[model samples]
Target: MRLFLKFIVVGFLNTVISYILFIAFLSILNYQASYTLSYCLSIGISYLLNTKIVFNVNRSIKSFLRFPLVYLVQYIFGFIILYLLNQYTKIENHIGILIVIFLSIPLTFILSRVVLLKKIQ
Candidate 1:
């Protein structure tokens, strides 16, 4: 319960950071490129928060290296959902983005918590 709450908090913060950066970059770059940049930037913040706050683990190079995979999976999965929603429901792009992010939070939190907290050995 506590972990999920923490995850939601961090995820909301990350989503704000991501959307701001995405819009900023979107003006100068293509949609996919802007989204990629924002997503990557959010991963850094997410990693720090998840390690120290949610998981109560010290930062590790091993965990950091693996961390992007979580976002990568989330990104791809989210994009698919966004695309489907857009196709079927004519949802606005930003709204689709929000829905996608909300849907992805659980899987992203689970993968990071389980894999990032374990010992390498």
Candidate 2:
């Protein structure tokens, strides 16, 4: 529970940063492009926070390399959801992104735990 809470906190911070970057980039880029750039940039921050703060694990080159797998999964699902919402529904890009972020939290936490805590043999 505590670990989950920490993940939530870190996720919240990450989301804020991503959202801000998305909005900033929206001025010059398409929504999808903005989202992709922001999401990719935020992955590094998410990895550091998840490893050191949420999971209390030391950062390693190996873990860092593996970390983005979690976000890649999240990004695929998130992009699908975002596309569906934007195309089929009346939801705006900004609101659709919020929905995607909320839905992704649990899956993100689980994947991050598996990747970050697994014993590498």
Backbone clash numbers for all candidates listed: 0, 0
- The residue pairs that clash in candidate 1, if any, are none
Against the true structure, whose TM-score is highest? 2
Ten-residue segment with the worst summed lDDT in candidate 1?
112-121
> For residues 16-121, what per-residue lDDT tens digits would candidate 2 score against the true structure?
9999999899899998999899999999999988888999989999999999999999999999999999999999988999999999998998899999999422
lDDT of each: 0.83, 0.92
Give Cα distance to truth, residue 45, candidate 1, Å: 0.9
lDDT string, candidate 1, 1-121, tens digits: 8878987887888789999998899789966677778888999999988888878887888889988888888889977897798689978766777888878887887878777866422
What's the lDDT for residue 62 in model 1?
A: 86
Error of 1 at 108 (Å): 0.9
